[model samples]
Target: MSLTDQLMTDMKVAMKGHDKVGLSVIRMLKSALMNKKIEVGHDLTTTEEQQVVVSQMKQQKDSLVEFQNGHRDDLVAQTKEQMAVLDKYMPQQLSESAIRQLVQQTATDIGAESKADFGKLMKAVMAKTKSQADGSVVNQIVKEVLS
Candidate 1:
């Protein structure tokens, strides 16, 4: 089934199970997905849907950092739970070592020898790893490799 259909099914199950947090998270994701579809003026392909999911996950991660700094333990715990739920929909994350390896490979492929080639290297690496690695992680790996 499509991600949207799967989400709708999960929403129904969450409702029946009396899972309030799960239901709320699923509702928000559904709304985001629908809004993204409207923005693009068509049904989302799987890649577009994955982008929407990743966007939501990024928002949660940002909020998590803010909550941590604010020392809001309750909010932090809640956000962590929501992040966990969001993660279920994302593609598997690449490990730092794997990301480093990818950066090395991309640099070799593109003949990127210096920091001046950072942009070219990043574009190539992102195209290859967009669905697997986080942007910040990839950026760090690239910096480490180039430096």
Candidate 2:
């Protein structure tokens, strides 16, 4: 099933099971997906759908950090729960080792040997990994590999 379909199914289950957190997360994601589709004026591809989920996850992470730094334990716990719900929609994340290896291979393939080639190397690796890898982690690995 497509992400929307899956969300719809999960939404119904959440409602039936009285899972407030799960239901809220599902609705938020569904809304974001709908907004993206409207903005693009076309149906979203699988990659686009994944991008929306990733974007939502990033927002949640940022909120999580803020809550933690502000010492809002209650908010922190709630944000963590929301993040967990969001995680279910994401593609399997790449391990750091896997990402490091990919960075090395991509750098070799692109002949990127210096910091100047960082952009090229990053672009190539991200394309290969798609939504599977976090950009920040990939960025760190790319810098380490290039330097």
Best by TM-score: 2
lDDT string for model 2 (25-143, tens) is 99999999999999999999999999999999999999999999999999999999999999999988989999999899989888999999999999999999989889999999999
Candidate 1 residue lDDT tens string, 1-147: 999899989999999999888888999999999999999999999988888888899999999899999999999999999988888899777888888988998899889999999999999999988678889888888988999
Looking at model 1, residue 6 earns an lDDT score of: 90
Where does candidate 1 stray beyond 4 Å?
none
Candidate 1 lDDT (Cα, whole model)?
Answer: 0.90
Best by lDDT: 2
Instruction: Tally clashing residue pairs in candidate 2.
Output: 0
> What would you estimate as the lDDT of candidate 2?
0.96
Model 2, runs deviating above 4 Å = none
